[model samples]
Target: MNTQYTDSKIRRFTIFKRLLNYEHLSYQQLSEEYFVSRSSIANDISYIKKQFAKEDLSLTFDNSGTFFNGNEIQVQKLMKRVILQREEVMDIDNLLMNQIANVFHEAIEKREIDIPESHIENIVLSIYLIIFRSKQGYTIKLDGKNQLGRLFFEFDKYPIVYDLLKEVEKCGIYHFSTDEAQHLTYLIVGSGLRFFLKDEKIPFSFRDRIAILIQKVSEGLRVNLTQDNRLEEDLVVHLYQLFLRTDAQTTIVNPLISEIKQTYPSLFGVVWFALSDFCKPYQINLSDDEVGFVAIHFQAAVERLKKKNKILFVCPNGIGTSSYVSAKIRRILPDINSIETVSTSKLKSMDLSDVDFIISTVMISEQRKPVVTISPMVTSKDMKKIMNYYIDLIIYNEQKITEKFEFSYETRELIGKDIIFGNFSTKKDALDYLFKRQDFSDELLKEDFISSVWEREKLQSTYFDNGFAVPHGNPAFVEKTAISILILDKAIPWGNQMVDVIVLLLIREEDVEKVEPVMNLIMQGIEDKEWFISKMMEVRE
Candidate 1:
């Protein structure tokens, strides 16, 4: 009932921690313990109440005393926050923390649970907290509405969590009740790190949601990602756990969010926009970290879309020369993924559907795909011809994809009407110039539009490491689509980066499909500042 802290701040923290432990400390008890006035205790409680209100938690009192009035999950989060602030409260020397971590590492490796390195520390700390609290008889009491019981199924689905806790119990000389065990499992599941559940089947709901997500992104990129089974599987595994983590109100940190956003800016924007719709029904506002994770998957799918060229070797000459020519072509052109030698006779029957193009020693009269005729010896002149043809084929494919959009990055159509050349000193000045453009006069006038842009900017600066920023508003506020460009004459501070260019996206609700290509253009500029500025200057001229 009575405790001594070095200072009022520490005393307040202690009181908050005790409340998290389900303690109902009265003013009289706390004041008497601290050798302070009752009003001083009241001030402490008032300060604690303000902190609790920040998290939408209530610090209430009754005839018993003052305690945290919230669900188990909220209480546990507050406890974790408090302990993490002054980890000494959990363990003065961190001996117990290290001991629990070691036990966890052993059990985790034994179970072969594929947890991300970022999540391991949080998981270890959570397990230690559960055991520490249980030893002190601060056991979890779940109500009927608590999804931990239903979502986790009490460690039956994740026995590794159960086993880890059992191991901790052996090391710490403490026993966990059923509720404690269940709480520990909930903590693990909530971290959003579980992957490769070989024994567990992914729910159809998760798979279905992932399918819809892939389709949405596929439409945006003008490429079908649904056919990529690996992408589907990766997303299903990630998003299923993400749903569980959301339900549990847990967060997973992604250290590479900034790099990911810059590296795959186009893919990141597409994923972020698509996930905004995907998360609306659940009311789950995903953090940039989560969006970055999903964007990584889509970026992989984009790489898959750029499949290497597969060549079908056709030689009217005998098998010996055919083999020689195929070998020679392979040695010369490393870009070709595969070369299959086929006699001209068999070429008629062979499936050209699987082959990207035909590489032949003899001239083919008809061609299903593009045919490149080279010498039987693979001569120097023929090598140049083949290389040119291959280059043309790749360019052709890229052109076909860009054709899906009405505007290309090279053309002025995307940013022509809205492009500005200014020497703005601040980010707001640059954005203000873009917002007032005639291109966005119809759309940016809405108060909601400006508010949404600032709101998103506040969440995370759109600044890229490549010396540019791609600031955007919420798609919901956009009715007419526009890509506003601000090419600064001098570099200005934007978030953590110095930006000489700003590509502000005003994407409409219906045309969300265009986000990818538009972002691709912006990223292209970011990668080559010289070329992008020259192009914009050319457009201006």
Candidate 2:
């Protein structure tokens, strides 16, 4: 049989032996005697009672106490079988000791402390060896100074030994004293070592010590194994406290956010956005640092939300088919926030500057923000397309911000035969040509094509110089493809600048995937002042 199975049998036998010894004891008393929880004791007692019943061995329990009347020899024989099956349990303890040694070795290699890896590993192994042998009924002898000797004997107490062993078994890291006697015992446990943490009583305040201890333990466990209970509890509590007192806006300023920024700055923007949304109900103000912390939580929450199909609904014109649209959206989106309804006139007038994405029945002309428009007769197919579009946009924006920025070499690198460049005399002229063309099959780009591109420009002026306005998608709202270059004979009012050279990129949903490869090229075209001016000067109708 597998050694793990044998170890399990031994554990079961140990529980059974303890139960047999205290057959008359109440479950609560048994729990105390075994140093296990009441539930564990009850479970063990229940299993033992079942076994007795299976064999037709009489057993009774009540207020008068419990008794077992059966073949004593047979009971002893069964107990021996369990004991024999558990012989490998001792080996498991030894293996755990060795695992501790390896952990210390790794920590040392990382140059975490001045202590030598070999020395730490040996010391931990020795300590565990002593404990393991002793647990197997062997006496341990120690020779060291009085303080060290006292620590070793105190460590032998069942409660302390059990606590330490349980921690090592569960967490794969045993924190023990580094006194000479304890070190010697640790060295003996190397054969069975799993991992070990030698307590370092450094010259620091209590709070500092706690922080240091938690850091060390978390680092060790995070690398050698999955995060343990202690780490999860500590991290979650730290985040909770950081967010608890913070208002939605200032939550981005926490130290945890700063740490994440240092490691991942690009993710900082998306994370900040998520934290802002999360803290919305609490009305907490977030700082950059707090935003970083919230980003981590947001990433985790989103992963879970994806599996559950969570969604939010937005509609313009509350009076029409908005309710029906909301119901259809609810069927597709899990964790659905209430469907929000706003009038088209109100939508056009109201500042939806901070809204995530708007889904509307009525098409508002001034959609200067992120909005997904659907017809009043929106069908299931329309819902699917809109949901997919929104989800893709969110994902794309996140990817864009997270990617590293690169410099482009020239304008020709991005604008070529497949990509055209020109300037428009008026926004109307540019709008007319882009929508009127039937060269492309993508309808989303053809329908309201001018407004969508113009909306992006309105968010921020795309003009890079006196003659150039590089109007492109927020890289978040693109659905279907086309890139247009319009050269205007005269300057026109574009956002905050007058422009003669306009490079309007019409990108399809699929083309957005190429943003990474062509990003540098686009940036290069915008940055070349002389080339951009030259291109504008040479533009024709």
Candidate 3:
């Protein structure tokens, strides 16, 4: 096993666990817990302390004990990065297995070794099973290769082969080889094998070589074999190349495509097309719904890849927010094709380079990214103004694409802070308050409050899932208006389901008509089950 990698993982895990358990734990205590010396513990602590300091956190030792007084959110973020890095090692391990398999196959095909086809098959199958079991954390017992009688039994047996196999089982990969053996075995266990072993089942066929490879490599690297058991530099390069090639050719069927298609056909189509293009080089075949899911995944991957200019948006679910956003960008900047509406989890992983501007009602940190935050209950006039500004920026800069556009301002202005909160037991009561607030102006109220909702609902219901509705009318329908919110004591039927919360939006017809920003905000806020529930439960006055 790679001792360096192993030690690093252990140190990280130790620090993380210690932080969670004791707000204050000394380096000495950590050393004792991990059975490491004081100096080593101190070194690790020093490194962590430096990282914390960069994020404006202080690590200090007091009379009581040593503790980290960094921002809790920052600490959590760091912890997540540490955990995800560990997960990435698993992926690397899987790649190593594929490299080994390709090596063996190529060797046999080139007649480099005089082994029978059956013998080769047996070797592959045995290695596959061993990797499968190891990934599942199960004990493996393999029959000796000598029993196959494929090669003459040597008078002096090399124990390194067996030792390497054991190490591979434990760590996912091992680099040791016997003097007698001319080549190395890069063993891997794939996701399929991991799944099977997780369920205590055995694979019936040997066709899932890719799965086996991934599982073995993941297990091996996770156990710290990669750094401890160093291979010849040439061999490592070859293995890496082979693994990349194999992974590029690997295909995974998306199980959720059918569900996505049935539920969201248009979204499925857009995703499917986008992913088809993205995975073209890798030769991965994604289903329509899977494409949509992959589109979201790609959005996340791109965000992580860019890692700057964080953007955030919130929008109501299934309310044409995503589509509108997509359309408005397409209309204003026809070449800006990479824009996507994603859930909050995906947003968390985003690279943020293309995210100079943000459009949302929710209160996300303005410190990390330049934002043009807005209310979910935005007026059409407000939406038009925001969209036009962005569009104009895109056009004036001659930036035909959203990615080319950068934020010139540090922050955009906040809109509609003058709105007050009010709650009503019934839709009528809410409408009454809205009408009364308009000074009993019937024409103005109908045009803004009543007509706009009727018009928007014709396109699609604002009712997302989980008993909520964002009702709004077109800005053109209003003379003058005030925004009103209603929280029904009981679920009132709206569109397809009973909605408990209704956000009545009023806007000017003269304003640029783009629902995309508002839609994006709504979707962003309610993407998560917990957050959505909390937002719904907000007390209305």
Q: Which regions of candidate 1 deviate over 4 angstroms?
A: 1-101, 109-163, 173-187, 190-209, 243-265, 276-292, 303-308, 312-317, 320-411, 421-479, 486-502, 524-541
Q: Per-residue lDDT for 41-75 in model 2, tens only? A: 66665666554432224355788555554333224
Clashes of each: 0, 76, 48
Off by over 4 Å in 2: 1-233, 236-320, 334-339, 375-378, 405-541
Tell me which of candidates 1 and 2 scores higher on lDDT.
1
* lDDT (Cα atoms) of all candidates against the true structure: 0.71, 0.44, 0.41
lDDT of 3 at 87: 41
Q: Per-residue lDDT for 1-541 in model 3, tens only?
A: 3344238655655575456334788767766667777888777776665444322244667976677554322343344334333443222245655644655566445533344443344344334433433354433222233221122112223333344344444554533324112111212212112211232322232213323322222232122122321222222222232232222122223345444434333233333322222333333333222244433432332233333322345444445665665455455445443555665556567777666565654555543555555545456665676677666655644333222112122101111322234445555555556545443346655655565465455544455434546655554556644444454556665533456655555545333122222323233333443453344343212
**Candidate 1 weakest lDDT stretch, 10 residues:** 402-411
> How does model 3 fare in lDDT?
0.41
Each model's Cα RMSD = 12.0, 28.8, 24.7
lDDT by residue (1-541, candidate 1, tens digit) is 3444647777887777788777889999988778788988999988777555433356677999988766556666556655545545443427777887788888878877778766787677666666666566555665545542354344576766677777877775567777667655665765534443554666677578789888888888777888999999888767766766655555455668777865666677677667765765454556666788888888888877776889998887888998888877887788777898887788888778878889888877797888988878889998888888888888887566433223465345656777788798998888877777634445545567888778766655666436677787777777678787888888897653467878888877677677776666665665567877777777653
